[model samples]
Every structure is written in structure tokens, then in C-alpha cells.
Target: MPDCSRPNRINIDLGPYKQRWVAYCALHQLTPSAAFRQVVAKLTENMATAGDAAAAPPTTRKHRKEIGLTDAELRFVEACAEAEGFSPTRWIIALIQARMGNGAQFGQFELAALGKSNLILLTIARQLRQIAGMQQGLAGGPMPELLPVVAEVRTRIANHTAEVAQAIARNIERWHGK
Candidate 1:
């Protein structure tokens, strides 16, 4: 085999444990070069340990209390949680975190966006109905000439709905990653 020993000419500072290092090498049946390699391996392992320590999850404390809710409201909360695929407690925790402006919270932004998008769709639908009525008045005919306008409005609604769906997908993906 090729030489596995490290060069002894290299200078190293053993600090206060220099004598202990010599004894440890003798006890472990290691040459000076092998002892140095072992020390380096230990140091590398400790560096990895420090990195793991830094990445450790933050601590959390939970305090629970009983809160009275009307039966109807409790049922509604449960229903909402079921629809969202979350436990009622987790859903409530998400809500509280959202209200507290915690970035780690889930669903709040997407929920708000979905609500707003639905409202916009409703408004667009209402406008289309109003325009159809106006076209009927203008043309004074059985079938209003507003068919094209109605078609255009329908297309816009579809586009808006698709956009909202895409946004929801993205939000869901982000939540899953979290």
C-alpha cells in the first residue's frame, strides 16, 4: 500500500492537552500521523454537529383553554375545517397566526385572494346581465344583438376564474412545501 502517514514536518499547536494527546495516541495504537488524522476527523464531526444545532427547530409552548361557543358556530367551524382538510384546532391556529401577521401561517393570503376574486367574478356577472338588459332596450327585438357582448363577458369570466385557480394551485404548492 502507498504511504498513509501524514508528514511530521508540519507544525501544529496542541494547546494545553499536548501531553494527553501523546498518551491518547499510545493507548489507541496510533502513530503521530494517525493521531493527527483522528483529531481532524473529530474536529470535522464537531463542525457538522454545530451546523445541526443551528438548524434545530425553534421551541414552542402550548397553553390551552376552554372557550364557550354556540352550537351552531361550533358546527360551522368544524365544517369549515373539514372543507379545508385541517383539524379545527389547526385551522383556528392558522387564523390566529394570520391575524398576528406571522409569515409561517397558512391559507390566509390565498383565502383572501379567493374571496376577492369571487367578488370580482360576481360583479362581472352582474355587469354582463345589466348590459344584456340594456341591449334589449336599445334593439327592441326578441333576441338582443348583445350576444357577442355576452360571449365576450363569459370568456373574460372564464379567464379570471382560471387565473384564480392557478393562484390557488401555487398557494397550495407553497403550503405543502412548508
Candidate 2:
């Protein structure tokens, strides 16, 4: 019998769009794998961009304004950079990038929230698994010899869940207050 695990690569006949893809890949200096990865990255990076061209948000063609910052605001920006262990200028640029929708800040926030909730549930599930493993280990079985390690992982996961929940709650409260 043939191995069923590997994916089959088939040559798809692209009637007209084949040239376009080739040209795009050539222009971007990408190999086949790199081109595919780039296309996927771009689509994943901007979900809105994957929509109909006419329905996409209007692009801002004008140059961005360089507004003067107050000393207090500058200090706050610097403090935030310090706290995050990033350069103040790069942090400001990242903020601008996020505002311009060049980066996935909104998507990241949604994913982080979802991950935090899932992590909490995963922690409890892992704990249960560890308890099961411990029971098996107590029965003189070698399969569950790593019960102590699993328990430690469960403890770390539980702590992480609490921290994530607290942060999420604080964000929600602050958002509602605004």
C-alpha cells in the first residue's frame, strides 16, 4: 500500500492567472515556496485586503503628518518604550503602523483574548491529565513516570491563566470606562 501521510503535489492548469502569478513572483524576487508564503502572509496579515478590491478601505495616499509632541507626552512615550523594552522611536513608529492598519494590532488583540480564555481551559484540562498520570504512576506503571513534570507544567499553566484573565479584565474595565 502507498504511504497516505504525504501530500500530493499536482500541477494546476491556471488558464489566465498563471502569467500574473509568475509576474508577481518575479517582481517580488520570490521562489515558488517563498512566493506562496508571501501571498499567504499578505492575505493573513490584512484580512480586509482579501475582500473585493472595490469594497476595501480607501488607501491614504497623502504623506503622514509629523505632529509636535508635548514634553509630558514624549516622556510618557519614552516610559512606555522603557517598560516594553523597545526603542521609543520604534515604538512610536509601531503605534503609527498599527493605526495605519499596516500591522495586525486588532487581530492580535482578538487572538490574544481568545488564546487567554482557551489557555485557562487548557490549564484545567492539563491538570486533570496530570492527576490521571499520577494515578497511573502510583499503580507502578512506567508510562506515567513523568507525572511530576506534568504537574509542574499544569501549575505554570494555571498561573499563566490567572495572569491573562487579570490583564483581560483590566482592559475590559478600562474600555468600558472610556
Q: Give the winner by lDDT.
A: 1
Tell me how far the alpha carbon of residue 145 in candidate 1 is from the true structure, in angstroms, after superposition: 4.8
lDDT by residue for model 2 over 22-134, one digit each (tens)?
89888888866678766666766666566666356777785665768899998988886665445777567656665555642222344466677687677767777777766
User: To one decimal, what is the Cα RMSD in angstroms of model 1 from the true structure?
Assistant: 17.1
Lowest lDDT sum, 10 consecutive residues, model 1, at 100-109
CA shift at 30, candidate 1, in angstroms?
89
The superposed Cα distance between candidate 1 and the true structure at residue 157, in angstroms, equals 1.3
Instruction: Give the whole-model CA lDDT for all candidates, comma-separated.
Output: 0.70, 0.64
**Superposed model 2: Cα runs more than 4 Å off:** 1-49, 52-65, 102-146, 160-178
Model 1 earns a TM-score of: 0.32
Query: Tens digits of per-residue lDDT for model 1 on 1-178?
Result: 4345854455678899888888988999998778887767786775667677545555587888777889998997788666665587887776666555454343545566677787878878787788867766874565555676677788878888887877666545444444
